[model samples]
Target: MAERTSFSNEEYADILFYYGAARGNAEQARREYGEIFPNRRLPDARVFSRTFRRMRERGTVVRYQGDAGRPRLEVGDDEEEILNHFQIDPTLSTRMIARRMGRSQWKVWYTLHENDLHPYHYTPVQAIEEGDPFRRMQFCRFLLNADVEDRNYLKRILWTDESKFDKDGITNYHNAHYWSVRVMGNPHLKRQKGSQRRFNLNVWMGIIHNRLIGPHFLPQNLNGVEYESFLRNVFHELMEDMPLETRQNMIFMHDGCPAHFRLAVRSWLDQHFPDRWIGRGGPIPWPARSPDITPMDFFVWGRMKSLVYATDVPVPNIEDLRNRIINAAQEIQSELTDSRVVKTGVVRRARACNRNNGGHFENEL
Candidate 1:
């Protein structure tokens, strides 16, 4: 248990004000507070959160600790067993765990809370196959070495990916928020029936240096031939606008999709990019299931999606959706790409992955 410290009323107000001004993200507000008061110890995130909620409800910051006098259950053998079980499998619910342990659900819940144990939903990622880490390390080393020799090496590479967008399926799902005093629920979005098939569009795009090459909607499902066809139409166009130097030194990056490795696609890439492509059957193998280090996965697609679906106004049809995507693409600036995608994204993420031994990077919670 954290020791109870009595803070001045002024200090409490200041903390609340800082948190509100910085939005409701506790960590962000805490960071700002740290910058302002380097000498004073800021409260833990949970403490800050509880105080902020109280302020929101009462419109004032108070020093009273509501449950301070209540006796906390002592950590005994039973608590240790509960902690052990929870540590082994966080998916076990309080009620289920209590039943298993022959204890009350409230006791289990209290024990978990006292121990600072909270359940978090799993984040989805692609499953990595064997030898994926070695491939990732090798590819990152290749880029790092090339960058060491030529500073512009990263800028010369084209980052590409395909994503599906559903017009009706755009909401901040799984983004529920709960206040300390009240459960503040997300607004329900009434989804239309048969919405996904009717409204969804699969689009492909490529980013090289400052240029966003395509919001090209794949006419049908992608196959070896279709992917090759898209490349044939867009590859030359992507290269044509670049400088002679960049064009000569440029590399192409794509994931290890079967379509990408097919003979037709491989042959076309070989002709256009030669040994400068990164993927299966190419010069450098792109690691399987490694999206954290890819600019397309980590940056481009996410930014574009946020831009496209940010508006609450319903997209009328497929054409409007495509137009929205194109408009979003147009709004994407060169500086944004240069700063976010290439320098901070690819290279920085590469180094992070290498440090993690090719495992997934820890997400900022």
Candidate 2:
């Protein structure tokens, strides 16, 4: 006969500890047991009840050799049912499957592992409309062809976009930490509001090859007039530092945002960039809803936000927030000068988009 598997004395003590902590509730004890010892196989609710009863009546957790109880778990008995549930709904968590099947979570978990099943996170992607993919493909081909004509084509094109920075920036709870020597309430970050209104700063930035431009703060409610003023008055000044050769050869690119589609903006672009600009109705039409191909969207904004909000404390006011953004932009500018990071990424993404027929190609890259 095969030797029987049994719980160790320490395991018995832990069961009793959780049982008492849960006020003798067997189901709660089982849950607490699974949480406290995730790697161990979970005992059924009946096991908890029996263990507690034995502790009270016999004053010990050790079982006699002749004790008659439930038979050892046979995974074969429930493996098919567990796997069937997963086949029907792969999103169902182990806990949900265990509850539905009246089995311990560890049992379902073990069955999954034995069957070579593993969990994967779902990636969020942009929604491609009916014509979006075709447009994206066409633009990607244009970019690839331009690269062939001039190796420095991607490096010379200037990319620009506007993003909003909030006072209460994003927090990744998984990475956030607080250490204490004494017991206390959980520390929290305060999300401050000004007169019942959330505060945010709208700023514009541009990237050309290894150069950074214009951390210019824009009005909260941006419009065509305001956008044109920025382009005429502020944008030209920002580009003055660039080499005459680069400024002359640069192809200005912005997305199909409402402001960029205005007649005034288009006319301004036409006067300045003639047949070189990319936008809603410019010389080269930019694909709508195509952030995956834009350096400003795919790289610059995310990088700047991460740097700006990597703070030990919340930004006190708009001035401090603005300063932090400018500092972050300067830091990114210095980093870009050292490496061809943004240029390389743009070319790689354009190729990936072409390969995927422009239908969400981030995964391939």
Candidate 3:
């Protein structure tokens, strides 16, 4: 069993005063509280400072104020409504209420959690609209169901997701800090409308471990037949290009889009590379709406969007978008070259298997 660390409420109070909400990080918090010190000393500014900074960044504390460049969070009007609503009734969401009240969704989420009133997020929020989460989860299940030692040796697992990249695309991920005047103005008015949402780079990205194989943008006006053709072409290209050991064992994962699932496409996959081609509906079992578990979900698109969309680059047309996406992908590939994600598909699937007893994610995939 894991050894648990324990402390009394008084010790906890000392911790909060010295290290947390009491502004006691480093030099100040320790001295003022004067609690038992394991090392009988104050923590250096860097250690406590970084931990506290991460706390602030992760929204553990409402706002870090009084210091230089620190943001001051002003309490908003609708907080009581959130505490009352989510607390009293279970089904309502910060987003739902905000939509009804015509407020920024962030403001609602912030107010609830900041006040220590937020209920746990019961499910993983869907990042992709119209995406089947369980289906994506099932694909992950299939990948992990393979011989782990062999798959790990060959790095043979891959998954794909689509994105539209625009030269002027802005896909930055931001912390939702309500009460920061810098982010949102007075309660009387709303933030300016039409901050960038979508981008012009429409790409189909293929991800495997630390490697990014493609940001393959579909040819203009691609449909089901075209997509199926691209699959055949890409698989041939991918398999042949691989080292000898890897080419024989690779599993190509994709969602159940009409292009992927159409009978015509199925026939082609069944005819040519019968056993090599693995898809959502493979024998292993899969779930829809499971991007929350896929490598592409965890590693690629969100990251790329954060890089490409977060910028103020100029992309007025598809050509400009394509150029920017190309440049950005190259830059990201280079920057993330030394970075390889350790996959958790096996661990996660094992837990899911426990939950299922005998069933599997790929049962429907």
Where is model 3 more than 4 Å wrong at Cα? 1-124, 127-154, 167-199, 219-222, 233-241, 283-285, 335-365
The digit string of per-residue lDDT tens for model 3 on 72-158 reads 344355766655665565446667778987888877766654543324222213333344444444454455555464647325666
Candidates' lDDT values, in order? 0.70, 0.78, 0.53
On residues 109-226, what C-alpha lDDT tens digit does candidate 1 reach at each position? Answer: 7776653344443444455568888887877887788889988888888888877887664545353221121122221212212212333788888887767777778854677888
Ranking by TM-score: 2, 1, 3
Candidate 1 or 2, higher lDDT? Answer: 2
> How do the residues 1-365 of candidate 2 rate in per-residue lDDT, one tens digit apiece?
24333588888888888988988677788998999899998986556666776778778665543334755445867987987787776656888889988999999887775444556443345566789989998998898899899999888889998888888885444422222111112223222222112348988999988888879999977788999999889998989999998988889999888988889999999998989999999899999888879888788888998998897678899899999999999998888866887778888998888887777777556
After superposition, the stretches of candidate 2 with alpha carbons farther than 4 Å from their true spots are 1-115, 171-199
With candidate 1 superimposed using the best TM-score fit, by how many Å does residue 337's alpha carbon deviate from the native?
6.9
Error of 1 at 165 (Å): 1.2
Model 1, residue 54: what's the lDDT? 61
TM-score, model 2 to reference: 0.66
Looking at candidate 1, the ten consecutive residues that score lowest on lDDT are 178-187
